[model samples]
Structure formats: structure tokens, C-alpha cells
Target: MRIALFVTCLNDALFPQAGIATVTVLERLGHTVAFPAAQSCCGQMHANTGYAAPARQLERLTEDAFAGQDAIVSPSGSCVAHLRAHTALPVYELSELLVDVLGVTDVGATFPHRVTYHPTCHGLRMLRLGDRPTALLRAVRGLDLVDLPEPEQCCGFGGTFALKNAAVSGAMLADKCASAASTGAEYLAAADNSCLAHIGGGLARHPGAPKPIHYAEILAATGGIRE
Candidate 1:
């Protein structure tokens, strides 16, 4: 399958490795991944921040960027959920594409680490991606998948929400960081880097907190950590 990767703005700029790891995992599964150079932000930030006009424009731009493709996949569940709601494009979150569309779970990945997954708000509530990510994680050879207390709670990284409601966001993030740290996992994995960034920022202030990593990186691993 020729899949067009919509490396969202955040991943394209700050977390390029997540996009690369996504491509690595897909290619390792015998599928070709194409990155549409014209692809840019999915306007999730704009829309969520009450900038309707700009959000619509970015949505149109995204529609044009991936005009024609067998399928479109993005590493960020938040971005995918926004596009799915605004456009008719056939976009799927990585887990949705892998477990639902591609009909595979393992993806031949091997990551030996104690890890816990935090279901992002978009992936958990909007896309309803239940057990798909964990199913894939469980298949990884030598991976110890631990349970996160209150896994469904939002990590307080609702894009602009974190900035606008800094106090509330920080409070929520504190609870989330505590929950993730209590898992006794070396890594805290999530489908969306936006949340990981927020949770990771909060976790960094403490010692011995599990490192935040995108699940795609975990899936892309081959008995060794990528980067």
C-alpha cells in the first residue's frame, strides 16, 4: 500500500523522529510510505483556539496536499481526529491504519522495555481507539506493558488549552505526571506527541520519571532504541 504521511506541524518541526519512526514501521511491514511535501499543519491548533477562518484555510490546504492517495496516515491522533471531522479525506491515525485498515497488530516490532501507554484525548474519546495500541504493544517481543492509572484522563495538553489555562493545565498535568511515574515503567508512551510534550515537560521537573516516547518509536524499534 502506498500511504501518504501527513507529518503534522508539531512533528515536522519539533518531533520529526516520530514521523520518521512512523515511516520506518510502515516500511518494515512491506508498505511504501510517501510524504507529501506540501503537507502542513492540520489546523487543529487554530480550530481549537477559536481561529475559525485560519483553521478552515489550513484544512483546505491539507486537503490539497493529500489530494489523491490510496490512504493517508498521521502519527498524531489529535491531528487525524481534527481532519476526519472537518474533511472527507481518508485519514487514519497510525494505530487505526495499522490495526483497522492494514489488519495487522505486531508489525514485526521488538522493544524490550517497561512501558505504559496513555491514550490521548483525541484517540481515546474522539477516534475511539481502544485496545488497538495496547494490542500492538503487547505483541512486541520482550516488552513489558504496564497499566497506567486513569489511562483515559487527558494529559492537560489540549493545544492552546495548556497556555490559556496554565494553572489548570499545570494542575491536571501534575496529576497525570504522578500517575505515569507511579507505573514503574521506564517509558510513558502515547499516540500523540502533543500530549507527550506536555506530560514530558511536567515529568522532567522530577527525578526518575519515565521518559515520554511516542508509541510509533516503540513500534519502530528493533531490539534497540531509535535515537
Candidate 2:
């Protein structure tokens, strides 16, 4: 299958490894992956903040970026969920692609870490990716997957929501960090890095907190760093 990797702007700039890991996993599965240089933000920020015009324009550009690919896959569930709102093309978040389209779990990965999974709002609700990610995590040879308390709750990193409601965002994030820490896990794993960053930031203020790792990174692993 011809696949295009929609490395979202944040991943391209801030979390390049996640994108790379995504490609690594796909290639390992024997599918060719393409990187379209014209790809950019899915304009979710603009749309969520009441700027419809630019978001529409960006949505068009995103469609154009991956136009003609068999399937456009992204390491980010949030971005894929946003684009699916308007774009006609088939866009699959990594886990969705792996479990639904590719029909594979385990992906020949191993990460010997006690980990907890956080289902991001978009992936959990918009994509309805129930058990897909956890299934993959459980299939991993040495990874320990633990249930997150109130897994449906948002991580307070709803893009601009954190900026607009700083106090409320912080409180929500604090609760998320506490729940993640209570599991006694070495790493907090989630499909969306944005949520991880927010929750991880709160954990960072405290010593010895479980750092958040992108799930793609774990899936791409083959004896590399656990975190």
C-alpha cells in the first residue's frame, strides 16, 4: 500500500522522533511510506479559536498535500481527527491504520517499561479508537500496560483551551499527572504528544515523575531506549 506520513507541524519541529518512529514501524511492516513536503498544520488551532476562513484554507492545503496517496497516515491522532472533519481523503491515525486497515497488532516491538495509556480526546471520541492502542501495547513482548483512571477525561491540553483557561487547565492536568503517577509506571504512553506534553510538564515539576513517551516510539522500538 502507498502511504503518506502526515508529520504534523508540531512533530516535524518538536517531536521529530515520533514521526521517524512511525515511518520505521510502517516500513518494518513492509509498506512504503512517503513524506509530502507541502504538509503543514491542519488549521485546527484556527478552527477551534473561531477563525473559520483560514482553517478552511488550511484544510484545503492539507488535502492537497496528501492528494493521490492511497492512504494518509499520521502519528498524531489529534491532527488526523481534525482533518477528517472536512477533508475527503482517507486519513488514518497511526493506531487506526495499524489495527483497522493493516490488521496487525504487536508490530514486532518490545519495550520493557511499566506504562499507562492515555486516550486523547480526539482519538478516544472522534476516532473511537477503543482498545486499538492498548491491544498493540499488550501484544508487545515485555511492556506492562496499566489502566488509567477515568481514561475518558481530557488532559486539559485541548489546544487553546489551556491558554484561555489557564487555571482550570492546570487543575485538570494536575489530576491527570497524579493518576498517571499512581500507577507506579515508568512511562506514560499516549497517541497524542500534545496531551503528553501537558501532563508531562506537570509531572516534570515533581522529581522522579514518569515521563511521557509517544506510543509510536514504543511501537518502533527494537531494543532501543525505553523512554
Which candidate comes out best when scored by lDDT? Answer: 1
Residues 1-227 of candidate 2 have per-residue lDDT tens digits of 88999999888889888999999999999999999989888998889889999999999999888889989999889888888887898999998899999999979998888889999999889989999999998988788888888888898989888999999998899888888888888888999888888998898987777888999999998774732
Task: Please list the Cα RMSD from the true structure of every candidate, rounded to 1 decimal place.
Answer: 1.0, 1.2
lDDT per residue as tens, model 1, 1-227: 56899989999899999999999998988889888888888888889878999999999999998987879999999899999999989999999999989999988888889999999999999999999999999998889999999987888878788888999999999999999999999999999988999999999998999999999999999885873
What is the total number of backbone clashes in candidate 2? 0
TM-score of every model versus the real structure: 0.97, 0.97
In each prediction, how many residue pairs overlap at the backbone (N, C-alpha, C within less than 3 A)?
Answer: 0, 0
Candidate 2, superposed: residue stretches over 4 Å from native: 224-227
Local distance difference test, candidate 1? 0.91
